[model samples]
Target: MSEAGPRLGGRRHSDERSSPQRSLGQRKPARTITIDGEHAGRRLDKFLRSQFKGVPAGLLFRLLRQGKLRVNGRKAQQNHRLQEGDVIDVPELHVDTAAAPRPAVPSTLLDQLRGAVLHEDDDLLIIDKPAGAAVHRGTDVSAGVIEALQHLRPELPELELSHRLDRGTSGVLALAKTPSMLRYLHGLLRDRKHEIERHYLAVVAGRWPADMDIVDAPLRREEDGVVVAGDGQSAETRVSVKRRIGNRATVVDVRLVTGRKHQIRVHLSHAGHPIAGDDRYGGRAFNRRVTGLGGPGIYLHAAKLVIPKPDGADLVVTAPMPRRWKALLNSDL
Candidate 1:
């Protein structure tokens, strides 16, 4: 097993010692213990509560659920029993540590960028995201827009991302300010009743007509670890060509009526005109054309989103094309 360090797409560690003035008050150092001959056969949670006094049972359970409490450096369930010679790793708990800090966003650029507000109430915030930024932590990155938002609003009781966005694609990003709101949003997503509307803009390899195009395909994980599957489950995507770019490419707008993993990219690729700069699904010749126009990020953007407001109204948000995309059009492609 690998030794744990700072998690990818997670917050940066503070070098300063824990202080009372900090948002999360002074924390007790984590304690690691090995079950020896005398100390054996104890329920993990039961033992932990006894060791750390004043910590709430609910909080302890949450830590365990989040995999913060581990046995032998591996995640252990709440009901797991510890035997002799087992090592328990306990994470430090700080007073007022409601949620982790969010990443910092530069104030200068915040005003310049047009981030359309999708839905905003006393308990929730949903923004229409652009393509360049990531939504969460993952293999290669740490700080994302969600983290940066957290840093901007540390006073929020419980800020959490309700859904995910691919690093290259973007759309409506929902944030819950309270646990109840988070649970509500989760239920909405699970029931497929998240009334949020999502749309995308892409430059595809070939010219498609203005007629409505629906691609119904199923997606599953491929052997290469990327998602790919035959038409096992129903996945639907609606595409309409907005304009023709050059001899080889056309600007298209896609509306995802039914959200699926890589639905647009997969469907468009399967249709033969993969999105420009999309190396994974795009043909080499199309990629070369986009590359010759600009550099190497996918030329797909989350164009628009519309969602019903909490107060019985509608909110429509849109993110304009990035400068690079405009530059690509200006160049001879």
Candidate 2:
């Protein structure tokens, strides 16, 4: 069908449109919606899916294909972006037996997230993200940290992720309570990365040399299954030995200079001290042990974060290393 992308804003021209046919008995009346500030940046299809929560997805596309739905009184595609002050003339939607409720976030998941809150003020919500949890859900995933958090905190309409941690790497994760704060954090990372410090504690397979502290190699993804290489993007990590597990391993504090994909894991591995229990990156043993799991298992933990504030004083947050690793050295942490 129609490919008139919904330009329901940034100046507009009106056109006439009709409602799709109603099913069964009484017909439903149509209504006009003026897009508000909160809904400005959302997609038309997503907005429709949200507005009429129970209606089956197929109906929206079917109506779009048949020219029944309109933006500013003319047909518009589902993927079109919505703008503040734009008017949407919505026709009668036959929300009947096919309409279904949004999937309920599991109680267990909600409870886990409720307890995960490490810091919360007006602008931010930080958590000790569990190792095995996915930040966002995929096709096969039923629930993720973001999904559960949304259900847990419905008051935050502009809630969003400030940054992401790999599903397997547990610890200090931040979620912005509003869009403005999220954008500020993003700008801070992009423009003034040095002002913020992110540190991770990882257990490596053997003694990490104290002299070799910084890894300033470039990393690129290759096609041989997958890998981190030296010829791609500039990546850096500053590491220091935190402790030693006799002669078998070393606990190190890894400060990220530049955030890169698999930077810590790959950098340490390349430096001749692969994280213990690492499989793909060539540790002596590939033990799938999840110490703080949301994914598989790894000894890495996001130990601390230093966030810069406009008030001059920086905010520093820390998460303790997982205790199970203490047994590797046979002592309390």
lDDT of each: 0.67, 0.72
* Cα lDDT of model 1 by residue, 1-333, tens digit: 123422212322111122233344567666666654323554677666644535767878888888897888998887787676687777777644344333345553244224446667766777766566777655565667665666556565346787677777655677776544565555655555655677788888877766648776777656552344664456778888787877777888888776767778888888778888987888897688688777777888777766555567766767767667876776656
lDDT of prediction 1: 0.67
Each prediction's TM-score versus the true structure: 0.64, 0.72
State the lDDT at 202 in candidate 2: 90
State the local distance difference test value for candidate 2.
Answer: 0.72
How many backbone collisions does model 1 have?
5
Candidate 1, which segments miss by more than 4 Å at Cα?
Answer: 1-120, 128-130, 170-172, 190-194, 223-228
Question: Model 2, stretches more than 4 Å misplaced?
Answer: 1-108, 193-195, 222-226, 284-296, 310-312, 329-333
Best by TM-score: 2
